[model samples]
Target chain A: MANITTNPESAGGSLTARALREGFYAGIVSLGLFVLFVGLETTQNIRNELVLRQRWGLLLTFVLVAAVGRFLTVAYVRPWVAARKAAAVARVRDESAPDSFFKRNFNAIAIVALILYPILAMLIFGVQGSLKWVDNFGIQILIYVMLAWGLNIVVGLAGLLDLGYVAFYAVGAYSYALLSQHFGFSFWVLLPLAGILAAFWGMILGFPVLRLKGDYLAIVTLAFGEIIRLVLINWTEVTRGTFGISSIPKASVFGIWSFDVGAANNFAKVFGLPMSSAYYKVFLFYLILALALLTAYVTIRLRRMPVGRAWEALREDEIACRSLGINTVTTKLTAFSIGAMFGGFAGSFFAVRQGFVSPESFVFLESAIILSIVVLGGMGSLVGIAVAAAVMVGGTELLREMQFLKQIFGPDFTPELYRMLIFGLAMVIVMVWKPRGFVGSREPTAFLKERKAVSGSFTKEGHG
Target chain B: MAPETNTATDTMTNDPILKVEHLSMRFGGLMAINDLSFEAQRGEITALIGPNGAGKTTVFNCVTGFYKPTMGMISMRQASGKTFLLERMPDFEITRDAKVARTFQNIRLFTGLTVLENLLVAQHNTLMKASGYTILGLLGLPAYKNASAASIELAKHWLEKAHLIERADDPAGDLPYGAQRRLEIARAMCTGPEFLCLDEPAAGLNPRESLALNELLTGIRRDTGTSILLIEHDMSVVMEISDHVVVLEYGQKISDGTPDHVKNDPKVIAAYLGVEDEEVEEVIEEIEEIEEGGKH
Candidate 1:
């Protein structure tokens, strides 16, 4: 058995090595292109006026570089890495060693990388301006990550298809918005209140669907989400209809400084620095970061609890879950409510961050994006969701900066136009290459002792 | 181990654990169970046997709260004299509150979960109730931890009883056919039910596997004091394990008595033989005479 496994690994390793070599060459070519772009931008006067006007050489060169880069990365780099890992695993097995050399080395490197990430980012962009990366990429994605994990408890763990997940998020956001706007409640007071309100809505959704199953349940939940959005859109008196509610209150730093109070006793002023609007952004960054971490921690803990296991069982088979004396209705309700509660948390955080709330924010597209994260990442896997969110959200954000591509496709080329095309291509490639997900294993939050990677076949297909 | 000769005064002889009083179920126009009345005694292996579509499964479903009866009632009295209206409760509450656990004709283990996890999930309600799902419990509260540990212990205990401790970590779906059936019963037992209803528990088992299953059911009845309501087609299993038997034909009770008595009944013979009812008595009498002549 061991020999059979090792044979495939060794074969895979050689393939990976070849891919790595190709990737190295592609990197060199891209670097040369970058240098050419810098030269063209700086030394325009040195070239003939006709040469600059035609620009055929630059356009041709840019296209060639992009084509070569893509070819090398896909045809060689990806396969090479996969083969190398496979071969390394085979070698470790042949030697009968517990921990491979790479595993031990990678752990140490990861620890160092994590420790230096924030410090290095601060140095590169300045602490105040670094808020963009921390907020947009970090906190924004983390909120979705939390929402995905919560949804996993329902759709992934309990096998309950809940399309109305955004309803709970809307509930939480509205809960916080209404309480603060009407009664002058603080962020601290409304955060839990939002969760409770969302949970209440979750139960409301759960009750009517107690007898529903399969596609029927899905349609009902989908309708429920649309209903919530329509209500927000049409209820002009309270929600202000499609105009939306603006100038919403932002979360403060323990009431240390009013955001509108100018630089006089502001948070940055206490540190003897000029208070920029970026100060508030940084504060919001850390606030959502903490909330996201708390969400992950709570979800992890819940999986080990009886209710968590019940949810998994329910997911596997409702008949068996009931036969085991689990109240299926209650278990389903708990999963729906708990998942909704987290959605609420993320929704409320979104409202505060943007300082606005609108019906458009809770559209079906948002639900689709979040669901894609869960499916693409591998259901019930926390780290997978985080990586998936980064890939989907960060990839789109990165597309906006591809200015070099504009020169190749002419000035008419807009990167955003190809965003959806690239996104769809990436999804198809991932699905074909790794159908069970990038991280295809059931990583239960809690276990008896040491955790091991259980195989991925147990979960729904197209998810981990 | 004389098989407990005190059966006359055992729980089986006292107030019946499950009493199906004139229960009838209809699907549109066809009556699945028609005026079927019988009592399953506690600590007794009672078998419900007939040919296919004899309403055995329907009766079991109605009793377990899976199907609502169109007419009649299923009254179950526990040792504490707590009478449960089985038809009134949902399937979940039937298992949780009434302590009525059942196995399906097609074994339905949580195939994705490990063998032990299947049993642990069966004990879900107990652990969840004990923990109260508070924030303290979510924070790994001591009581919650203890309950979780106890659940694992119970799971391990049942896994050992089912002779599946070695395969505890394997997915339930990976088990061989017979082991999967045994695991299903063990999972049901983990729920700590007062009565265990098995739908075709020995449907696909070989002769030896079926005999082993009989021993397991007998042991459950003897040790746990759990009433056994089994719907089986295997005559050997029905004759070997069942202390009482109810025979159904066309959704009605044709015969009800001890296994031997029902086995010899003309009505039961006609149901299995597919003969006219008028010819049943003639065939039974001839068979009895032949038996008597052979004995002499």
Candidate 2:
């Protein structure tokens, strides 16, 4: 086979012209999909006279942005990829060099920031506006951070591609919701139960799918998640159908039930805190912070243990793992259950935090977002997962407040609607740029004389 | 087919660690292993040598619990005096409980893991429990830490024996081909198996590495008293390390004896040289003279 190497100079073309030519082709495709399809409906306004007027300005701007973005990407990304490939041989050897400062200290800095979340929230957003920032960015991102860490065990360490992780999340949420609503179980009481229930479901899903691997395993897991969702939606008597179970109850602080309080009898009032939703939001933030920390601590410890090594071994080569006397069945099941257990903790926390449990929240998109967080964060990396969760989840939330874009794109522009579009673009760009995400370097769980962090170059995306 | 009364020529016959009785493995209509019986004696090296597709790997797979034979039984006697039907158990149970550890024909080290971690993973069952199923280990409990330290010591010991101690912290994939092969054997040995099954351990090794492998195998037998069943195409390795040689031709055992006895066997030479029954004696004489000269 002849290897084809095309140099820009050999091609005898200007970079801008080449990029513009490529961009023009990509722009045509984008224009067809965005302007002719998705954007057309969004821009149309059927006013009082029943006239279908098109917002041509927004459509044109969208096309131009897409074209320009593609042009710059074509111009820069290609050479960058070529350079990365050129350094590939040396990179693997250089990977085991002493831990780079950023990868080593990212956790300490992140933890300090996380520890001071409440104080930081107070300073940045203030008492009145802190609730939104804390609840949406802090709690929401932490919940996902916990979820990604959980999924990391299965997809990252075990090399099991699970597309139905949300099933376990739903199991946790519903376990808390149903237990709380039907029997009036308190949040503290149902917390562990939710985890146990989700783990049980994880095992149930794990058992029948032991024979599957790679893509087949992913499909089965995806189906399992959908089944859980479909069951939740159809099992109307228990789940209340699509209406969802609401007003489930807030998480109690210090095991003392918050229980039905209106100002005078409010727990927050008694504690000398403001008797507003901020109190609940702030309480939930701390609760999730504790939960997320627990997940990280456990995951870090497991990585160095025998069970953890078995998971990585199985990921490396199942046949080799089995030949070496590692019980793959138990290893895989434990990965699923343990991962689901953390997802369950996050899920029940979600229930109490939102005071609502719905099939809508446990959609496939939720699984995709969580999976993306794991992948985007660098699989098997706890700090990376946390960072990724904050970037992805917090980035989407920030988009809602991107009203400043109205100055350029017109007042009709809602940045919120382009969340998925932006997310998809960001994912592609990140994948192209870093493939391994923020902290791709991995410090060997067990080492001999020298302790060096191995870069992602030595490990596969799914491999530990 | 008769349940092991005894055969006269059973070398190292103090106790047979592994017994294959009329084990026939059929893949659809194809019989990979015919009704063949053999015993690997305790604390000795047994080599299964055969031509390509002669089902040497098939026998190894069946013994290691990777395959379930269509007919007959593979019984493995553990060091604890408990006998296990390997065909009945899962792959891991054969390695764990039955104390049978194996290496692949192609090296299958945990490429992403460090050399030490690869060996540590082979000792998974012991450390997994000591870690209290990861709970105490996660908490940095003393007992689990001690177990982890001990396992690392064991890993280091094997790494030293395999001459991989210097590269213990290196990723297994980054090692050279010969080193990876040695690492795979060391990893399997770290499992503390009573019976070691190696498929082509010296397959791609250079002359020096092959000599090192022979020493490693001999050391395992002499020091650890591990009964090894090896499948090798390298005649030098088989003749030097193996106490008993079993030759297969089209899934049937053609010759079984000490290396010299098999080297002098007419049928063995005929199978290797692809000759008629009448021409076997002539070829055997010719091959024996050459083997004698090649020995030096």
Top candidate, metric TM-score: 2
Tens-digit lDDT track for model 2 on B42-144? Answer: 8778999988999999999998889988999999887678999998998898988999999999888888888988999999999988988887777788999
Model 1: colliding residue pairs: A12-A83, A13-A83, A16-A80, A19-A76
Clashing pairs in 2: none
lDDT of 2 by residue, A142-163 (tens): 8888899899889888989999
Give the runs in model 1 whose Cα sits over 4 Å from its true position.
A1-118, A257-265, A444-451, A460-464, B1-3, B6-14, B134-136, B275-296
Alpha-carbon TM-score of each model against the true structure: 0.83, 0.84
lDDT of 1 by residue, A140-186 (tens): 76678777877777776777777778888888888778778999887
Model 1 TM: 0.83
